[model samples]
Target: MLTQEDNTLLTRTGPGTAMGALFRRFWQPVALSRELPEPDGPPMRLKILGEDLRAFRSTDGTVGLVSPRCPHRGADLFYGRNERNGIRCVYHGWKFGTDGRCQELPTMDSGPAREKAEQNVRLNAYPTREANGFIWSYLGPPGQVPPFPELEFTTVPPSHTYVSKKLQQCNWAQACEGGLDTAHFSFLHMALDDGEDATAKLLTKVSSNTDTVRWMRNDGAPRFTILDHAAGLILGAARRGDPNENYWRISQFLMPNHGLTPNAFPGENYHGQCWVPIDDVSCWIYNYTWNPDRPLSNAERDRFANGSGIHAEVDAHYIPIRRRENEYLLDRNKQKYETYTGIDGVSEQDACIQDSQGLIADRTTEHLGPTDMGIIRFRRLILDSAKALAAGDPPRALNHPAAYKVRGGGAVAPATQSLPEVLQARFGT
Candidate 1:
């Protein structure tokens, strides 16, 4: 458990905060690429890391992330007209380009005086990159911006990937730690009193192998082995399997706030999530399911679109249909008869519990055990990185962009085999 001071250091990520500074150094997904479906489309209202911003797709198809308020008269850019190649504030006909520099200030005549005022009066803008259905922006010191981590999902063909984002109404750290804490899968995702095939029935869409489900159900207490790497940590949890074999669920925790789930088998879809903080109390969980081997089929895509695995069924605004206001639509009868939590979807179950940990979990009051090793290391990594950045040192993950290409999945190996050997046998890393 963290002390009160350490907990504060971990949760608060507003501007000027140590954690916020560390997050800003890395590229963050500010909006989905599809949000601004076309050039000169409406701008998106964004509030990331406690900063109000706006995102727009320019005529060249490049994305722009800038302060929402027009510097001219403090008018909100959400009401601005996206015309030509820039956002023109209707308040006074002030046009700002994707770079946030005033492109045209109609209030002043087009002359040396106008040019000087236009150049001097500009909105705060950050750099943006569009890849794999996301509009990512770098919001740190211009000199300190690192190369984007080429996450495997973003590198795949568009047809092979399905990306979505849902509002997670809780602190970013707790939701993130939930992803790294694979031990909860044994209970949180289990179907209670549903006979011998209960586990299989519940996780059929998540894990193709029924035996893997059985292993997860039988061994609630998985032995963990964590390995540190350039991008983040490789968390390996081993559960007892049939005979001499052990079922290993290996996951990846990338940098400050990304987690790759371990449910995929060879030829199956790989899944990951990025918890980009909207504020200290909430975050947008950007989720992706990608097949590295081939394109996703229409049926598979439809299933995901309707809510399956990590994908939640969200409304047009990207808010989950089953959310906090509705108590995640809990059904006690279903809890007693169907699944353990009475929650219909895996994503909803996760959200229901994480949000229950208060707006922010008070780590100072909790008890932690060995199974929480991944959670512990995750906190240590980011907390330490935050402190190190404060001391004028940068994180090592920023230097190894290619390391983000690594994958996480399940494997079956001898109980005597080490995690390294299992990783080799499964992924040939």
Candidate 2:
């Protein structure tokens, strides 16, 4: 368990906080690219790392993420007219370009004074890029921006991916830790068929085979092995399988906040999620599924779009239909007969439990065991990085962009094998 001080330090990520500074060093997803829809469309108001910002696409499809408060007279840019490549403040004819440069100071006289004002007045803006289906923004120090990490999902063809986002009503860290804690699958995502063959039909078929289901059902406390690398961590949870084999569920945790699910095997679809803070109390979970060798079928796309795997069935606003206030539409009968959660989707089951830990989990009171090794290591790595940044040392992951190109999934190995050997046999170095 963490001390209260460490717990507070771990959860609070607002501006001026060490944790927030660490987060700024990486590009963060603020919105899905499809949200803007077209060039010169509606400007989106967003809050990331506790700062209010606005985003708009220019005539050339360049997205501008700028402060929502217009520099002149402090008018809200949210009500601004998105026209001709800039947001024109409706309060005045004042306009700012996607780069945050003042385009027109029409309220002033067209002379030296107006020209000077246009050059000096500016709005806060962050560099943004579009990839996969996300609008990723860099909130770090200018002139020090690094290349975007080559997350495999972004490198794949658009046809090979399905992306969606849903609001998770809990702290980003807790929601993220939920993804890394694969041990929970034995109970949280477990169906009534512990010994039956029904649950063997893997939810997404990444971790398939009936023997795998029996292993998870029989072994609640999987032995944990953590491997640290340039990008972040490789978390392997090994459950007792038949005879002398170990069923390993391996997941990846990328620095700052990304998690690759351990459900996939070779030739199967892969899944991942990014937990971006909406604030200290809530976050947006961006979910994606990809097939490396081929384009996903229409039915697969429809399944993901309508809540399957990590994706949640969301309303028009991206808020999960079965969210915090509604108790996740939990049905008592389903809990008794169908599944342990009684929750509609895997994503919702995760949301329900994570949010139940409270808006911010009180880590100080928790009882952690060997099964929580991933969670413990995760906190240590991130907290250490945050503190190290405060002392003028940036994380090494920032420089090793290619190191992000790693996969995590299920691997069954002899019980005698070491973590590295298992990793090598499953995912070659």
Candidate 3:
């Protein structure tokens, strides 16, 4: 549990806050690449880390993330025309390029005054890059931008990955903690009273095999072993399995707000999520699934698109179909017989519970246990980083970008094996 002061520092990430400053040191995804499908397309309004901005693709196919308000008369750039390698304000003929350079000031005559105004009147723009089907931007101070982390999904071919985002009506920290707390799988994502065969069938619908489901169901209290690495922490939860083997679910928690799931065995599609804060009480959960060995099949893509595993069935606006506004379409009868939460999708179930923890979870009035070691360590790591940043020391993860190339997954080993040995056996690190 945390004191109220610590919780405040952990949750609030607006501009000028210590947590916000720490997040600014890293690159953050602002929009999906498909959101700006064609060159010179319409600008999309984006709000990340409580800062309102606009994103557009230039004629050269490069993405531009700049201030949404025009510097001339505070007009919104969403209505501006994207053409000829720049965004032209519809209110006036002023045009700005992807680098925020004032290109043309047609309203002002081509005189000395016009040239000076064109040079001085520039919009604030952040550097952007497209990777892994997402448009990422560095919102920190100029010249201090760090290199992008070598996430495995972003390093793979487009055909080998699928990416999507959904809105979550809760604080980013709590939603992120839910992803790292793998011990909840035994109850939160399991069947209640369904027979073994029916439970296996339901689990299969969510992309898990019967062996994993059985191991999770049989061992509700998993022994945990955590290891600290350069980029982040490796969390391994060992559960009793068949005769001489222990089922190990290993997960990775990267700096800032990224978590790699532990459901995939070898050859299965790997999954991960990044909880980008939209504000103090809302967030956008970006989900990525990739198969490093080969390209994802059409059926697999279709299943992900229609809501399977971590992917939620989202509307055109990327909001989940069953959300807080509709009580997540909960069915009491289904809860009593079909599933534990009466939720149809695993992502929906996660959202439902995490949101139910209130806008920002009150850690001051909570009780934590062994299963919560991952959550505890996560809070410590981030809070310490935030404090260190406040003291003028940058996070070490920023300097070790290549360390982010690690992977996390499941494996079966002897109970005597150590966490490092388990990781070596599974990921060959």
| Candidate-wise lDDT, in order | 0.91, 0.90, 0.91
Q: Lowest summed lDDT over 10 consecutive residues: which window, candidate 1?
A: 193-202
Candidate 1 colliding pairs: none
State the local distance difference test value for candidate 2.
Answer: 0.90
Cα TM-score per model: 0.98, 0.97, 0.98
Alpha-carbon deviation at 10 in model 2, angstroms = 1.0
| Model 3, TM vs. native | 0.98
How would the candidate models be sorted by lDDT, starting from the highest? Answer: 1, 3, 2
| CA displacement after TM-score superposition, residue 178 of candidate 1 (Å) | 0.5
Colliding residue pairs in candidate 3: none
Task: Estimate candidate 1's alpha-carbon lDDT, on a 0 to 1 scale.
Answer: 0.91
lDDT of 3 at 28: 89
lDDT of 2 at 313: 92
> lDDT tens digits, residues 145-211, model 3?
9989999999999999999999999999999999999999898888875556757876776446689
